[model samples]
Target: MSHQRARGQPALVYRTKTIIDARGHQVAIVDTENPTPVTAVFVPQRSSRAEVAGQQDIDVTRMIVSSDTPEVTSWSRVSWDGSMWDVVVPPAYHHGTRHTRHYSIDIRRRPS
Candidate 1:
């Protein structure tokens, strides 16, 4: 059996994608063809609410650091532990040594 890493957990991220539909209408949809699999390290964050320019108040719940940087955008959502969390912003990539190469992602719990 493979041993699980204490700092890394399996996670899924749905990157933002656009495609043309039947009527030649372009539509933005979550790329489900292949959910990006990533090894994420969960970061504890205090729940906070903030309002964007015209959007409603958003409660940011948690964050995750991953070594992989897919096409995830601010509109992307992360599915973890059977729950979906909205990406708070564009994935932030930190440039550093090989061991520190990772992306910092903030996410909010999706409202029911």
Candidate 2:
């Protein structure tokens, strides 16, 4: 009998690294070459739209539902629909009563 937990890999998540420049200033560089590929989906949060409704704030929020890559945090970023988004909060692991699990990460649109 096979007893392997099924995991899916569907998308790529880009991450940035902080490095000190010659002036000793920290610089964040995005690693687009070696992205972390995982099974994740960016779900648009209703609160995000409602919050920005009739407001000057252009920020759009989303919940990244992933079955893997629990390490993804506020330091991570994702490119979707030709725009980059920044993670706004840490991952929230949800454990269902039936033993189901997933990671919920809140992300906001990166300002230009």
Candidate 3:
């Protein structure tokens, strides 16, 4: 199925990286500069309980983005509905003859 025909919604992708601060401390920085506006569909996979002391509920969702989306990596995250989801692994890229057909990434709700 073509991506254009799919039910796509607007999503923001955030790229994060580790950097050394002036105090010689390592810190992670998140950049939203020139954020790529991609159309994606959020499909819920399953919910599981966290193993931590709080036993928080973790929601696993699959975000299917357009093939044209760029700069997405495991270090990237998606923002939707005032919630931030972390990309758990490398995205699965589906390529067509000329270009990428679609991309799928598994994201999980950030543990509080």
- Highest TM-score: give the candidate number: 3
lDDT of candidate 3 at residue 22, scale 0 to 100: 93
Task: Write one digit per residue (lDDT tens) for candidate 2, span 1-112.
Answer: 0011233324557777778999999987766676775555556563433355465434655554535563565678876666677777777878654335666777677655
Clashing pairs in 2: none
Sort by lDDT, best first.
3, 1, 2
Q: Each candidate's TM vs. the true structure?
A: 0.71, 0.59, 0.75
**Model 2 misplaced stretches (Cα beyond 4 Å):** 1-11, 23-29, 46-57, 97-99
Per-model CA lDDT versus the true structure: 0.70, 0.61, 0.78
Comparing candidate 1 with candidate 2, which one achieves the higher lDDT?
1
**RMSD of candidates 1 onward, in order:** 5.3, 5.6, 3.3
Predicted candidate 3 versus true structure: per-residue lDDT over 32-87, tens digit per residue: 67566677888899998768886688898998877777867777888876788888
lDDT of 1 by residue, 1-112 (tens): 0122225777888887888999999887777667887767766565644556655545564454645557788868888867888887777777776666667788887865
Ranking according to TM-score, highest score first: 3, 1, 2
Off by more than 4 A, model 1: 1-6, 21-25, 48-59
What value does the lDDT take at residue 107 in candidate 3?
92
